[model samples]
Target: MSKIEEVKAKVEIGKTKLVPALVQEALDEGSTPAMILQAMVDSMGVVGDKFSKGEIFVPEMLIAAKAMAKGVDVLRPLLAGDSETSLGTCIIGTVAGDLHDIGKNLVAMMIESAGFTMVDLGVDVPAEKFVEAIKENERVTLVACSGLLTTTMPALKEAVQTIKAAYPDQKVIVGGAPVTPEYAAEIGADGFAPDAGSAAVKAKEIISV
Candidate 1:
């Protein structure tokens, strides 16, 4: 198999050593940092699909993310340390009144692993914060809302409406335990994600389409 394909397979199998070793190989072969980054990102995309389908669980996802991060760390400086220019920017957070952040954090990592620059606002993010981030960061095209609880889920709707009202072209994507695609549509969100891996895919879809 080709080197990139080998790296992708290793990532799918959740091998922690795969990325770092393949990164070294890529560097030795005089592959550009950009090429290596794209390979790693593609691997993460594969991992995301497997995760969404339940072929891989959270622990495996974390392991693959860690590997991807290691590869990125090695290539960061060589790429001029510009994560945003290389990977499109994205804003993500747990919606207001929701203190739980495990799911949000996972989604952030998965997105980052897929080579999207992430602005993680953490938990309890108000609707205004989402709008402010979108306005300030024009590079940020995708906004992800996560709420683990039913009570705090309304924040997703509020944030989506507030952002869309301010920028009619904006796209808001909602996820978390209590969120559904129908509910996302009802709230005027652009998309819904069933899991963190799917969230990464959904973010890419919104940005590309």
Candidate 2:
């Protein structure tokens, strides 16, 4: 098979150690840096879909993301001049009264892979902090809020509402264990994703519109 396809396959299986070398090999074989990068990104998209479908769990998904990260590291130098996927800065954080981070971290990585510059606010983030991040960051095209609990769901709503109150047109996407599309709509979020994989897709969709 071609080096680019090999890179994609290795990344999907989470071959963290092998993906870098394969990416380099693909570069050696005359594959353009952009094409190789897209291969890895597409691999993550496949991995994400599997995660959303329950075919794989967190460890598997994280492994694939790490593999893609390794490949990206190999291509980062060559890609310095290629600003094609820059969707602008995205602010992400878990809502207040909740400390869960695995989901948020996963979403952050996937969203970054999809080309947005991520500013992660980490866990237990208060509502105003989301707005504060938007105000502080440049070209903030999207804000992503995560909540992993039923109780902290209100914090998610509060966070989205606060950001909307401050910046009515700010695009917000919400997700986590307890978040639903209906709830996201009620909370004034621009979008809702069911899992980390779809979060990247949702982030891109929110930014594009």
Candidate 3:
């Protein structure tokens, strides 16, 4: 198999060392950093597909994301500075009343690995804060919300409504343990993801549209 394919498979299997090793090998072989970065992104793309299909769980996805991140660090200087290469920008946070952030953090990292610039707002973020962040980062095309509890899920709706009221063209995406596409649609969110890997895919799709 090709080196890129090797990286993808290692990410799929959650091999922590394989990612950095593959990245180093690619660099030593005279591969451009952009090529390595693309391979890393494509690796997560496959991981995202598996996640959406329920072929993998959160723990596995998180590990794969971690591995991908290690590889990205090696390519950042070479690729991140290339404005022409990035897909878009994203603003992500766990909605107000939700202190749990492992899931949200993973999604944020996954989105970053997908070649999007990410501004992570951390946990327990209010709707107004999201609005303020969006106002400041005009390039942010996607607003990703995470709420692991049923009670906190309402904050996702509030954020979506608040953003839509101010910026009618903004897109809001929701995710977390308790969030579903049905609930997301009910709350007027633009999209929904069940896991971090899928969240990356969702961000890519939403931003491109």
Candidate 4:
């Protein structure tokens, strides 16, 4: 098989140790960094789908994400764009009372790869922390909130409302398992995405407006 396909397969199976070397080999074999990165991203999508289908559990999903992350580290410099023309800083975090970070970390990685500098607030973040991060950081054009549990969905709303109220023009994107496009609209979020790849797309789209 081709090096790129090998990279994808290793990532899909959560071969954290081998993915980095395979990603490097893909690059050496004339595969563009973006192509290799997309391969890994696609692998993550398959892992997510498997989870959704109950074919794999959280441990498998998490391992796959870790493998993808390792592969990304190998490609980061090549994948990154010129910082002088960056979209802007993006502050991301899991909403208060939620401890899940697999989704949030993936979104942050994707958004950063999309050319936005990211300031991650980590998990269980309070609403005020989102505001503070915006205030403290320069040119924070987007705030992406993630919540993995239905119970923490309210915190997502509160975070959006709090950020919007404080900075009326701030662009915010919300996501996680329990969040929907309709709910994002109702909660005053500027955008919503179901996964990391689309989160990057939506983040770019909203910030350009």
Each candidate's number of clashing pairs is: 0, 0, 0, 0
Residue 10 CA displacement from its true place in model 2, Å: 0.6
Candidate 2 residue runs with Cα over 4 Å from true position: none
Q: After superposition, how far is residue 113 of candidate 1 from its true place, in Å?
A: 1.8
Best by TM-score: 2
lDDT tens readout by residue for model 1, 1-209: 76666666776666777677887787887777788787778888888888889988999889888887877777877877565444567899888898999999999998787667789999999999988998788577788888889997678889889889887888778888888899999999999989988888888788773
Better of 1 and 4 by lDDT: 4
Off by over 4 Å in 3: none
Error of 3 at 146 (Å): 1.4
Query: Tens digit of lDDT per residue, candidate 3, span 40-90?
Result: 788788887787789887787778878887877777777756876677678
Model 4 global lDDT (CA atoms, 0 to 1): 0.86
**Model 1 bad stretches (over 4 Å):** 1-3, 81-85
lDDT of 1 at 201: 83
lDDT of each: 0.82, 0.90, 0.83, 0.86
- Superposition TM-score, candidate 2 onto the true structure: 0.92
* Candidate 4 per-residue lDDT over residues 1-209, each given as its tens digit: 99999999988899999999999999999998878877876687677667656788767766777887788788878867644536789999999999999899878866765657789999999999999999999999999999999999899999999999999999999999999999999999999998776677788789873
* Candidate 1: count of backbone clashes, pairs at least 3 residues apart or interchain: 0
Alpha-carbon RMSD of each model: 2.0, 1.7, 2.2, 4.3
**How do all models score by TM-score?**
0.90, 0.92, 0.87, 0.69
Rank candidates by TM-score, best first.
2, 1, 3, 4
